[model samples]
Target: LRQEYLQHFQAWAKSLGLGHSVQPAYNLPLGMQADISLVEAPELESLGFNEDIDLYRQFTGPAHLTGRNVISTEIGARRIGAYALTVPALVGLLQDSYAVGVNTMVIS
Candidate 1:
């Protein structure tokens, strides 16, 4: 029943030219007929690059699930570090994102 609902939802989403950020292994499947249909990174504290790597695994796990090599992230999307987010911390964040297979980004 869940799979049926998900399939129906996927079809509806694709019909609207949209996709959801659902984990294929957990809930919804990762394939949708949108220009871009993948996971999205949420705000995370600058807990160092090593620790941050795990933060995006959920998002990156299916980054390539759709056979599309597009990976993306949003920079400075955190209030934990505030404006104090230094270059190294930012680099670490980007590096972590890269390590997790993020190939695109939107810095704001």
Candidate 2:
């Protein structure tokens, strides 16, 4: 149903002389978080100021040197919305990013 609606909207928008292209969505697993603590400092230190490092460094500090851009799940389940947890919950959810030492986050 959603696809149909999008398709109809796209056609209508195009007919109105507006450019409309629906891009593919990026999907991240539900309940996943950044883990920034698992990385070894030496590995991060060894990274050169190359293109790869330039791309990664924008998102995190030495702890998050995975060289992979972090993309998050934009939508969450109702269960997540219903829950109320403490800082530990945030810590656990972000352990992966923490393992890699991500100091900054990019929403997209």
Query: What clash count goes with each model?
Result: 0, 22
Over 1-108, each residue of candidate 1 has an lDDT whose tens digit, in order, gives 544654666677778988543333332343323222323322222232224577467555544564546555656555565577778867877787778777765564
Error of 2 at 39 (Å): 24
Residue 57 miss distance in model 1 (angstroms): 1.5
Model 2: lDDT equals 0.33
lDDT of each: 0.51, 0.33
- Global local distance difference test of model 1: 0.51
Which stretches of model 1 miss by more than 4 angstroms? 1-51
- Clashing residue pairs, backbone N/CA/C < 3 A, model 1: none
Rate residue 93 of model 1 by lDDT: 74
